[model samples]
Target chain A: MLKATIDAEIFREAIEAISALVPECRLHTAEDGITTRAVDTANVAMIAFTLKKEAFDTFKATKSEIGVDISKMKNIFNMGGKGDLISLELADNAQKMAVSVHGYHYSITLLDTNTIRKDPNSPTINLPGKVVISGEDLNNAIKAAAVISDKIAMGINPKDQTFYMVAEGDTDHIQREFGKDELKSLSPVEARSLFSLDYLRDMGKVMSKATEVEVCLGIDHPVRFSFDIAGGNGHVEYLLAPRIEAD
Target chain B: MLKATIDAEIFREAIEAISALVPECRLHTAEDGITTRAVDTANVAMIAFTLKKEAFDTFKATKSEIGVDISKMKNIFNMGGKGDLISLELADNAQKMAVSVHGYHYSITLLDTNTIRKDPNSPTINLPGKVVISGEDLNNAIKAAAVISDKIAMGINPKDQTFYMVAEGDTDHIQREFGKDELKSLSPVEARSLFSLDYLRDMGKVMSKATEVEVCLGIDHPVRFSFDIAGGNGHVEYLLAPRIEAD
Candidate 1:
């Protein structure tokens, strides 16, 4: 059983982050808050998301795993206006959840968890190099590189103490290097990995609103992005696998 | 010879109005300003547009006809930042037109006049019923109707002194009626005609910015939408052929 009232904007922000990586998820609800860990079908990306109870205006829940259709949540919120108070209620052992926002009532049938893959375990990896930068700057670099190639390489240049993102096209390449002056903070360590722009582009939009995002990198390994949302009451992490660079 | 400088925004508004109907246009430039009239490939709709000299920051020109690729202009302008003054130059009988906005210089090859359709003659028809309403309201009605069906009927009822727009779908219909309180002014003349919503939706976007739009209608005849752009220095008219309303 679960009942909660949350600001529509904050709810939208949370749902958008989950929807970016998967169409559906197994949401774990507890007295403290809700959390979800899921990987893309192709196993190219993974998202670990949490919305703490403090982020909601009122919250109550028992330990339970709820199957949520992320796309359906998007459609439901689209009908709501800004600043609306969204109320969500689920009875014990019920297959349907009741949602009300701005005079509209919607009964959404929960997805069958048996059909969705079990929640993935967050992998443990060592990434020594790290940099914190404004989300806008990170998204801008991703957009600029996408204009030249479908793959982007991000790394920390130890010698210059800079973070750089570069994309190589068949005949041309674009690069953006963030020096100490532009970065919020940086650990001058060696790191470089190539990633597909398709996944980064989707994740970039969600991160663009964050004030600061910590990007962790490793040599020839997956990259991780960590950021806070809902005024720091909620948190999100994105882990993207590196692509093989063909010579 | 022709050389002129205009605000990027005003120029975009005028081109967008024309491009909604045709992709290419034979632009006629004179000392007074520029004018273009073209019909869509299917000839189901027509656009009559004019941009006076007063709308430009600097203007000078001799009588000439220039072929303009509307879609190409869209691409060029996409590179220019807002508030940038666009400079257009064409030497006497030159095949290339120089367009400079911001720090970029683009030389566009003019399409062959012979390859484009000749100027379409404007048909003279009497449309007695008229209503003047805010462009926002007009566009809103068009959008609301589009959700119901592909065809919309616009009319002025003599008995109620009201303007009505209605659309009928397979099993549902939506109707919006503007009384004296809602419309700026309405002519109490019996007029009704059905038009394809595809054309209206494109035209609606351009009209949404105008302060006021004048709508003229006739019995089983075409509907005419007239509005001003560039702060009254320019004008645009869209005449869409009526579609048969099947039972």
Candidate 2:
């Protein structure tokens, strides 16, 4: 078993930034240490990794150690990177587990040690409205609206065959329009949703790594996206809460 | 004059990533409301940016409309994407300049626009050491050292005829060694220097954009590097201060 603690900001900065540039990462664990697996097919590619036992001492003060799923740990550790070394410990029977990064430790006591559910069932979401569009275009549209407003209000009117992302502030207001079929597949049921620009921007981290994303929309409902990732093994789903309209 | 208030992050993220990817942007001032420029060719590419006066309300807000050097603005806008919409204003006399990004508006009073140096000055240090290696290797080395320490200390001794990069923390330390005459030239004069890992990492940004780089090392002095960038006018010179260490 292996356990370690590291600078949370350093971990996030490296994982988030680099993961955005590549696909899924394979984490390797052994009796002596832990290793990360990533390949750069691109000519300009490189990966630097290192981990020590002392680094994990902060988190695993008394507990001996545990192996970790770098992928899940990466997401769980995204809370602004300010914590002592993350700690990991495996149960004596080696059938269950616990992991923590930057003081945000979570106990997954129910997980089966031998089976890592690659496609765990993500929360089932039935969005009232939907659309299909280029990730690039959608990313750009979000960026444009985000310039002036902290949150973007997206509305799709199937009858009108239009999709809109709007943001308004006291001194600035922006409305970006993308044709119904410009880059997305849209359903007629009209729906509107609002989400923080910050979260959406963070979402951009995964856009390029994954080719296509499906966005589910509803009035004041949380936005859900299903990523058709390159790898056939893992199932990752993201859900974001929407900001309620004052009116 | 073009002025607009864009989201600090949206603008910064796109510009920073793109600039790091491309070298020497060709900024064309639209004579009749159209301008185009091409940067880096293969990995990362950017095309014409079309913003009509209607789209650019700030253009409608001012009378001074002139094309300015984008490269300069790109350099000064180094605080990262937090600098929201950048303000491009032509001086009343058309010589000075002003830039507002990320809430910080800087007024750059130029001594002489024509005399101001646009090119990075090449230092004449008669560098005692030279190395030709994979940009990836160097980037990785710096990254590893950066993890433990703020600055990387490098030692070059003729007696040992070796090059070393070391990072030492209170309890953590790392060392990377390169063979003598790693590249093209190696002189007898022994020298050692320490420089900020952050700045070196910034220079490393060009690594992915270029294949091979020539590194020049001086004793207790600034380090210089030149990259044979691909695509457009690809060249950059980065100078960094040496960290003093008392033995």
Candidate 3:
């Protein structure tokens, strides 16, 4: 059993963050919050999202797991007005979830968890390089890179104490460097990785709304992006596997 | 020889109006202004556009005809900022038209006039039923109708002095009525015609920017939409052949 009322904007942000990586997810709900961890079909990217009870205007739930169609949720949320309160309710063992927003009632059938892939265990890896920057800056670099190439390389220069993104094209390239003055913080350890622009573009759009995002990296390792949402009451993390650099 | 300087927005509007009907057109240039009349490949619709000298900041030309690719022009204009001035220059007998906007110079090779379809002569048909309404209102009705069906029926109710648009779907229908209070003017002649939504949707988008759009209709006849652009110095008329209404 679960019942919750959340601001439409916050709910939209949360759902969009997950939908950027996966079409559906098994969401775990408890008295304190809800969380989901899922990987894209290609297994090239993973997204983990958590929304605390504090993010909601009203919240009540028993520990439970339910399958959610993130894409459908996105469509329903698209119809809602900003700042509107969206109420969600599900009876114990029910297969359909009820969502009401702006006088419109949506009854969505929950996907069967048995048909979904079991949640993967969070992998442990050592990523020494880290940087915190405004989400707009990160997204801007992603967009600029996309204009020139289908892949982007992100790295940290320890000596320069700067983070940089580069996309090389057939005859030209685009590069953007964020120095200490431009970033909120940086722990510059030498690290570099190449990533596919296809995934980054979607992730960038969702991350752009965040005020600040923490990016973690390592040599030839997957990149991790962490950001706060719902005024810091909710959190989202994206882990994208690196693409082999073709010299 | 032709040389003209016009506001980017006015040029964009003219190009968009022409592009809605045909991909390329034989544009006629005179000392006084420029004009184009072209029918879509399917010959189901035709567009006539005229831009008077008053619409341009400066205008000079001889009697000439040149084929223009409307889609290419749209791309070049997309780079311009609002209120920017776009200049066009064509030397006598030159194959390329020079366009300069925002300090960028582009030489576009003109299509051969012989390769383009000859301008269609405006058909003579009496459309007695007339209604002058806000462009936005007319466009809104077109959009609403499109949501339900691929064709719309427009008619004027003589006794009630109302112009109505109706679209029927498999199981439902949507109708919008514009009474005298909602229209700039109305000529209540008993008239009704069915038209394909595909053509109206594109035309509606362009007409939506006009303050007023004059719609002329007749039973079993084509519909004619007339509107002013470029601050009334320019005029555009769209004539769409009606689709047979299967009982």
Best by lDDT: 3
Tens digits of per-residue lDDT for model 1 on A54-138? 9999999999998999998987686567889999999988899999888889899999888999988879999999999999889
Calculate DockQ per candidate and list them.
Answer: 0.04, 0.02, 0.04
Give lDDT tens digits, candidate 3, residues B1-247.
7999999989999999999888899999999999999999999999999999999999999999998999988877876889899999999889999999888899999999999999899899999999999998888778766755799999999999999887776533556778889999999799999999999999999999999999999998999999999999999999999999996
Task: Give the better candidate number (1 or 2) by TM-score.
Answer: 1
As for TM-score, the candidate ahead, 1 or 3, is 1
Over A100-206, each residue of candidate 2 has an lDDT whose tens digit, in order, gives 44222245432342443232223455787776666676777777777777888887877787777888866888987778557457777788888878767766555
The docking category that best describes candidate 2 is incorrect
Q: What is the lDDT of candidate 1?
A: 0.90
- What TM-score would chain B receive for each of the candidates shown? 0.98, 0.52, 0.99
Worst 10 residues of 3 chain B by lDDT: B168-177
**How would the candidate models be sorted by lDDT, starting from the highest?**
3, 1, 2
- Candidate 2 regions off by >4 Å? A1-14, A17-124, A171-173, A205-211, A228-236, B1-148, B151-162, B169-174, B180-247
Worst 10 residues of 1 chain B by lDDT: B72-81
Order by TM-score, highest first: 1, 3, 2
